[model samples]
Target chain A: MRLSYPANVKIILVPCTGKVDVMHLLQAIQRGADGVYCVGCLEGTCHYNQGNLRCRERVERVREILQEIGLEPDRVRMYNLSSGEAPTFVAYAREMTELIRRLGPNPLKHSKPSIRLEEAA
Target chain B: MIVAKRKPFEEILQMIAGHRKVLIAGCGTCVAVCLAGGEKEVAVLAAEIDMARRLKNQPIELGQTTLERQCDREYLAQLDDRAASYEAIVSLACGVGIQFLAERFPTIPVYPGVDTCGLAVNQDVGWYEERCRSCGRCVLDRTGGICPVTLCAKGLYNGPCGGTNRGFCEIDPEQPCAWYAIYERLKGQGRLERIRAITPVQEWRDTVPRTLLQPGYRKPEKAKS
Candidate 1:
């Protein structure tokens, strides 16, 4: 199977997407990621049973946390696809990249210094 | 265990808005088990607050720490030196822990990060149900270990009210009638006779603000040499 997606997107593989935690997504945004999304095994087909479902829940939770903190919840998403469906995976990557491109860079990226200064004051 | 849930993020933002530096103190005991105010929750909250402050251009200095048990003086003592550095402290412990911190650090303001919900037992992963009202009485032996004070909406002592429909409570169809449950449980144990016994009016005095002093530990009468 051959497929191509945007080069800008980076992937971090986890043993199981269920292992993805709320903090992991928050940290990604804190570290300047304009957008983040999780690609998990298709719903109900997760090798570890509910791992994909758990990932989906975590993604939604992170989205809520983002909204609470004044960020657009659309910056993050969750997509499900089986291992054999490379085309769908590529499509999701392109879709996420397009979404992020529209959202622009994360607001917290350049404000690190100002935040620290205000904190100290 | 005492269960709680985090306050809405917007309310918390409003609370610490005036302070530039704030410390989020988490408890590693009950709140942690409930997934509300544990170490992981503290980190997530810290990051979210930092981002919110940054977004508002009102940047705040955030610090995070978790004590083994916020209810204990020994664990709270760990925050002594650092507590002074921050303008305010956001305690992620239950109501008790928050008050203790406020009393110990009279100079610093302590805000509650979580609302202490109630005494509950985990029904399933991420699910909890209240199990005890701390009514200052012991009736479990007669009630087949089910607590009517906590489970029954009316806190009926002798039996359920007429509001019971089948086995479900009238207040909510989803909830099983506590007295019905007690009846079934006792009947199964060949103890239905207990239900017929009239329970005396509960003494309300014991339910008031009360303290228990362990009788075993009295200061050893000044040891005479």
Candidate 2:
């Protein structure tokens, strides 16, 4: 389908949503992507059986870590839908983009270069 | 393996609140397998702390390194070249590893990021249950494979304290009575007679710090003096 989604919703294609690691989401927010979310195949219908489920777990893990770090957990999320639902995909994209706008920019939008602790000592 | 649990994130943040730079060291042995401290956990923590401090406007420069084992001097030597650069260290190792890191880096403040739980068995991912207390005594021959010292609420050596309710301990209804399990196991193995014999009262080890010297590692009697 030649449907349009928010252009700001930069897409990163993985072999499977299960391929997304916890670090990937954190790194995005740390590097100033105000928000990050994963769109995986609907539950129980992942291409690789449990890949999408695993993706959900990782997404939840990142969300929890965000809360623990005193950040908005909603900044990270996971959505599932069938491949044929292009409109739903667009809807989710718009929804997430709106959510991020409401949450404002990631506080870490401007990170100083990370240096070794020893260098500081 | 010695199991450990990570301390609260707020506690960790407080431990380094005054420091502008710190190192989070990880251990790759027991704590790693238990998922409390490992390469992945270290990176996740580092990222969390980085973002957290930034948000607080008290940004910190954090460094992370996962070693093969932090308890051994040889492995810790890997950080010798750069250990002096940090004002503080948050060790994501067991209590022993934390001590070892402290001993190795005496000048810098060393804080424990995890609480050493004790010996445990990994039943599954993110699940670890304590199984031993390392009391410096082994009595498995009489108690069957179930450890009375650990499983029992009172750490009884002989038998249950009569608080067992339907095979579960009265102290914790969910936990099966340690002695009851021992008796059932002994009965299955046709070794019920072992439970009948009273285990001699063990001498209290009042020594503050216990040291064990392997036969080959100990000095000869003549040289011991």
- Return the TM-score for candidate 2, rounded to 2 decimals: 0.94
For candidate 1, what is the lDDT? Answer: 0.87
Candidate 1 residue A119 Cα shift, in angstroms, is 20
For model 1 chain B, give the 10-residue run with minimal summed lDDT: B216-225
Model 2 lDDT per residue over B111-208, tens place:
99999999999898989999988777789888988888889998888888879888999988798999999999999999999999888765666635
Per-model DockQ against the true two-chain complex: 0.42, 0.50
* Clashing residue pairs found in predicted model 1: none
Docking class of 1: acceptable
Error of 1 at B87 (Å): 0.7
Tell me the spans in candidate 2 whose CA falls farther than 4 Å from its real position.
A113-121, B205-207, B219-225
The candidate maximizing DockQ is 2
Report the C-alpha displacement of residue B127, candidate 2, in angstroms. 0.7
